[model samples]
Target: MTNLSLQAVKKAFGPVEVLHGIDLEIAAGEFVVFVGPSGCGKSTMLRLIAGLEEITSGTLEIGGEIANSLPPAERGIAMVFQSYALYPHMTVYDNMAFGLKISGMAKPEIDQRVRRAADMLQLTPYLDRHPKKLSGGQRQRVAIGRAVTRDPKVFLFDEPLSNLDAALRVATRIEIANLKEAMPDATMVYVTHDQVEAMTLADRIVVFNDGHIEQVGTPLELYTQPANLFVARFIGSPAMNIIPFDVLKGGDRPALLIKGVSETVVSLGPDDKICAGGTGYLGIRPEHLRVARDGDMALEGAVLVSERLGELTNIHLDIGQDDPLIIKVPGMIAPRRGEKMKVTFDRENIHLFEAEGLAV
Candidate 1:
């Protein structure tokens, strides 16, 4: 097991910089997940750590040793890609043990490692089966088992579950969570575009945006208190409902006007640099909005659509002047489209942000 650190790590292709000075420390035994949209340079950062790609600048350390000059094999890291890289003719057992054999390990040691990995991955029954005979999930398991056989200090997974079906992905995700539990000392870094996976699996999520670290924290922290508008909108389902508003107070008490809704007085003064009468956005999550069972901070609207996903329903409302706002209502209380509705949310639940996207 090892702690991995990247100090001011940057990557470039010719003159185009892809990663902009990433500084991160992955603690030993921690399951850290890098999550972002496509072209965010998350995969590239993982490749740099695996030594699959050369570091354009900065230092990379594994177990307190500088590894920038080291090759992939000597980096003490094993990588599992999205595509299960397996041998067509070789059986599962042979495929898992091939690397050890090529490294000149003793036959008995290779047998022990392969058997142990197979048992750990529940692949003992499929060891003699060819890749063509296994299911998609099994093939992915075999790919993971191959990496586990290496007994690497650090493990890198690049969207290893992307190719599986929804059901299989859930099962495999549990399998991976168990793998981390079993190997408590092994440092694992995962990269994915799935927010649900990131929220569920990671001890701490590193959110990347345009080759830079956007926000790094536990899933709920980033969701609840995003530093900027991009993260505020990006992390939530249906995203946060953002509407333009004016600051009503800045000299003494801080208050923001929500146009037709109501003027919300802040819990504290806008010493956060929000000027009076300046344009900004009011952010409120769909789940945070309260259904107007009674008249309280009421805003009338007509329902445009209602999506009932069994346990909960998402109501999209047309408020006339503003863009459509979604409200999450618990249970199957189906509200008809074009039905009149009133929505309200407490001042504490509302988020205030400056025009430049910064939270104020």
Candidate 2:
């Protein structure tokens, strides 16, 4: 097992800086995923770890050794890219053994490693098949098997499932997860824009935005307690609903008057910073909202659209705000357009953010 560390890592191309003082520590055998939108520098950070890009400044350590000047071949890491990058002319077994052969490994050892990786990845049955004859997933497995045969200390995957179809992506994702279980001692760093992959596959996830690290935590940690407004809006599907509000009364329990909604007192911890006459943002996830009970504080809005998606329905309501409020409820229920709908959320589900986007 190998651990990775990055201290104030910065990368720049010409006068444009891409990574801004990133500091992170990844434990041995941990699966860490980097996720962000395009041009967000997640992929650039991955390349820096792989020694494919030089760090403009700062330190990178792998297994307690400084790796800043190390070449890619000497880093003891195996990478699987989005493309399979297999030799079309070579059979699966040959493709898997090529790297070992080029490095002058003993033929017996090469055979053992190739067969072992093939068995673990379920590619043993197609060892004699060429890339042209194999399915996309199988060919990708060949690429992974080639990496596995190297037995590197760390594994890097750069959006390895992006090229496959929906079903193939799901199947390959499961295979990758199983491969991690089979090799528990191998450290892994994966980069992808898909939150589903990051949430499901990672032991911890690092969220990046605009060349800076926004937050890093386990999936549930980021989902339940985002550090700021950007993370609160980015982590969940359909995003969290944000509404502007005025602080009517600020104390241990602050009363917020949301626009077009009744005054509601929110219970906050003692350490929360809130003051009277201040304006802030109120956030609630769609799944947390429900139909209002009699005598409960509610926000009434006109139903703009109802999307009945089998297991759950997404109801969009116009609450006199810039964006419509969405409510996610179980089962199929279609409310007529322009009908008044009332919904209320629990106090515990509320998230308060100050004017500067910092969570309170």
Against the reference, the lDDT scores of all candidates come to 0.86, 0.89
The candidate maximizing lDDT is 2
Q: Candidate 1: what lDDT?
A: 0.86
Q: Which stretches of model 2 miss by more than 4 angstroms? A: 250-253, 261-277
Q: List the residue pairs that clash in candidate 2.
A: none
Every model: Cα RMSD to truth: 2.5, 2.1
Each candidate structure's TM-score, on Cα atoms with residue i matched to residue i, is 0.92, 0.94
Question: Candidate 1 lDDT, tens digit per residue, 205-299?
Answer: 89899999988888888888888888888887878998777776535666566565344343333454553337788889999886877746566
Per candidate, the number of residue pairs that clash is 0, 0
